[model samples]
Target: MTRTPRGEAPDVGVPAHLAEHMTVAEQHDWIAGFLRRHPVSRRSALRRGSGVVAAMGLASAPWTLAACASAASAPVSVVGRHLSFGDDPLRSMAMAGELTAPPQGRVVVDLGQNGSFGATLPVEVRRLVSQVPQADGSIRASDQYFVHALATGLQPGQGYDYRFRLADGTTTDTATFHTAPRQPTSPWSFTAFADQGVDMVPPSGLSGFTNAYYKPDDTRRTMTPSTSMVDRIAATRPAFHLLAGDICYADPSGEGEPVKSTGTSKSPSGFDSFDPTVWTTYFGLIERSAASTPWMFATGNHDMEALYDDNTARGALHGYGGHAARLDLPRTGPSACPSVYSMRYGNVGVISVDANDLSMEIPTNAGYSGGSQVAWLRQTLLQWRAAGSGIDFVVAFFHHCAYATSSTHASDAGVRAAVAPLFDEFSVDLALQGHNHQYERSNPIRAGRSTTQVPDGGTARPETDGTTYVCVGSGGRPRYSWQPGEVDRYRGNPAPQGDVNVVSYQAVGASAKVPDAVDWSQARYLDYAYVTVDVVPPPGPGQVTTMTLRTITDTGVEIDRVTLERRAR
Candidate 1:
């Protein structure tokens, strides 16, 4: 519920003419007063037994009461607690949490060792942004505010427990997060996926992100496959998680267009509605793992929430205003590109790119960053690859596939235009991409062609074999089928779909259906899956350093694995 004031509800009837203008709180108050005035007895309801609801004519409203309930529920102490790395992961961390409204005053964090509490307590920044009206200038269901906190000068590689304390003396549950190590000394692993939109299930637990049951008998709802996939990811105890892009499909249209005025949780209008409440649902879904470990994110085409853009900061281009508020990603990259930044973990340097700025399939936000992003990417790559940098491997994760062979969204020519040369020049070990809604690993490519064949379980020598590309976008909104006569040929055996042709779309702007025969696709899987990459530094002197990449399905099945090996300098 939207933090109702400490007063009695208005004991007034809702006038027919004024009902349309009534706020959700007022509607709730009107219902309370109506119930107080006319009590219902143990009898059958009129007009399909709808009870007092139908009698009040609210049941006949074009919108959904389900929406009202979603916004009208009791206030939560805390939700959507997420962790991220600050300028320096080893010495700093950031947290972002959501509340229905500003706390009675402020939210304090009590941090300590992983299992303990109260090591350091301090009041943090509680920036309150009143829930704006809906995208179409309609009343919002609930008040949503975000709180960001930064912890610096902490011990490196140490796990800490923290919880929020509101001024009202109420405390939230505790979550533990581990800081990044000060240096690359040992082995670790991380998981990556993309295109995982907020999935709403029906009562029967069948079918997709759209809730089949628009109106349910109660508040109970089912879970989506992506939710279960989070648990599977958690089981791996990854050092961190990287969502390549298309994090949550708040704008189901995948286009940064104006939203429909009538869209709500009750009537999302099926893949066309622009419901911001999906963000609320998404944060709640990922809060568990995101709270525990750094959940780094990238922007996808659907993530272009133009609804939050303002003429001011972080919204001038890319329409990243919502991300700037909700996520605490590193901002040291190109200006105006919140999603483009680079950080190092252990011996691996990871970079997040704003592929939407270079995407051709959906070019609405393309070139939003001008040419500065390319410059920053080049500088970051050069810095990481410089001698004495101690970085043995570099991985770039983004939305558009620089080199993929899926039918729906094949390799993006724009991204290939910008980053392909840079990646090959810097010997980027892995280019983890997402747009294509399947799993595909390409042979190590140099100059836009395969330099070496690195099949599943094969060794990839990026120092010589060039950069290998993997498209693991099957994080679970829906599955995309393989292209016609384009089978996932492996070990000379093809999937039951069709021929073993290497044809795919080189997704450019208009007339983008162009397909070309490719010879780089090495492995492919059409299902809901993610990739776990293990980074093992050299065991000792004269030992070879390696990064093993594995593709695991949502059902915990490991389908493909490849080892990228490089001799330690």
Candidate 2:
């Protein structure tokens, strides 16, 4: 029984005629045929050792194949573990293990628990590979250990397989993963959501919280652990995760505490000082999904606490001041104010701004004045226009909103006054916000007013070269009810409370029946949902890009969808 370079178990069952120099595709086909002829049963002893090899007649006896195959099978137990992004491709893999080759690729043997344990693991191109370190502190060993290898510049849109070798001169395990599509036109889809905090607890004894408000009715809702929300979201297998804000309730020390509404006495330390353990729990539940895809975050009030020195800044008061500086975001703005940035993908430009920075005032009792963030926004928009960047679609996301109907959080009049004009000036197509905890959508509006007001249950305003606002804060956090008469559009009735509204939209632009609006709707209801934005490019030049927003429920159901088009200015 001859072994492969990676030292995997010898292919004893493989016929001698087909054993040499077969391509990967041919090897796969050969394996398929062999499996069909000899159906291996899980309960059969064949999997243990030579029992199956002896039946195949590949060796004089099971013992003969074991001596030759043990060396190869020894390494099969090691596999790839965690993979990440690194600045230098060569140096990146070095942290994991030694380099088989510097320029092209290298291999790291992680015999530690974090390394691959003879299981199938994925490897993607351009990703920094990691695995458990070797336990014996040596690369060579027959012991079951984990190993991770790193490779770079693999072609995109292609699938590749990797094999790990053991010190006993045998290959251990094999696994496969696909590279991301190279071009924008490649087929792909992603998921987006906001306000998924770690402290949210549903009502008890319920399969899922049905009350619109977050109040728990039974032990089930209360017992449904906050981390499970991450697991639920991961089951979707989305290409990416978009967190609107409040990822960790780092400020509040204990669980189930009302976020932010508590007085200064309850506030925690600075943001960095806040325990990362909360985030660890949150990530632990969803690492399976997050490891495969990128997570893009938009700052909410909770994230901004660290930046402020005032009483309101308590509870891990580290705002967006330098938040984005540490992240691997696709885009970042001026260094003076690093939190605000914009990145354009395909025809869409997603602008993430620090609304908290815009709210800061002088230390003394001084009058209100906008900060550098405001100036940066103006300059960024102007630069895009000056460059004649044909941005067909614009989506701006922040913590606060110009319009909100949630009773829990009143409309942030200050945010509306500060950012509304800038959005109008730039003709931003869509504005997404959280922090209100309720679900609300506004008519296409510019400046401080709506362009057109449709009647109740009527369709959204037509494309008019203006921006449409969406409040999607109900991402499994405590919900809040809307104040009476504060919102022009209100729709809550038969409120059994304890339920959070999950809103969805799509870009089809087709007419549909609208549900009865909720009046006195509290945004505090516990709910888990996401918004999907699909940009359908037009058939020809001078055509509009159709934008559809879909609100998906926890059960993979799309409850609501809205569509819009980019009107020619």
Ten-residue stretch with the least lDDT total in model 1: 47-56
Tens digit per residue, CA lDDT, model 1, 1-569: 11111111111123323323333234344444544454433221111111011111212211121222322333435667888998788878887776643355667787888467755456544332212223333322222456777888888888888887777677678888888886657788999999887666221111226544223431112245577678787777789999998887754434222223332233244212344445656777787788888999988766664434442343334356667777788877877687888888878899999887886666656676778899999998888888878788899999988888776678888888999999988899999999788888888889888887766679988989999898989787565667666665433234453432476778765335566677788887776778899988876545799999988777677778899998765
Candidate 1: what lDDT?
Answer: 0.66
Candidate 2's C-alpha runs over 4 A off are 1-183, 186-188, 199-213, 217-239, 252-274, 305-327, 360-370, 385-390, 453-465, 485-527, 567-569
Worst 10 residues of 2 by lDDT: 132-141
lDDT of 2 at 235: 66
Count of clashes, each model: 1, 86
Question: Candidate 2 at 116: error in angstroms?
Answer: 14
Winning candidate number (TM-score): 1
Model 2 CA RMSD to the hidden true structure, in angstroms: 20.7
In candidate 1, stretches whose alpha carbon ends up further than 4 angstroms from where it belongs are: 1-76, 118-142, 201-223, 252-271, 311-316, 489-501, 540-542
Which TM-score value belongs to model 1?
Answer: 0.79
lDDT of each: 0.66, 0.41
- Tens digits of per-residue lDDT for model 2, 1-569: 21111111122122323433332224334544544554433223112222111111222212111222433332222211223222221122211111111112223332222233433323222211111011111110011111234445445444444454443444533333344433345323445666665543111100112234356542223333334445555565543456666554433332312112111222233111122122323443344455444456666545532211111211111233223222344335645433456765445666776554442111110011236667777887776655446556677787765655554444555566667888888777777887666556666666545566432233443335467777777666665554443322223323443322223211111122122232212222234456666666554456555667666545454545666676322
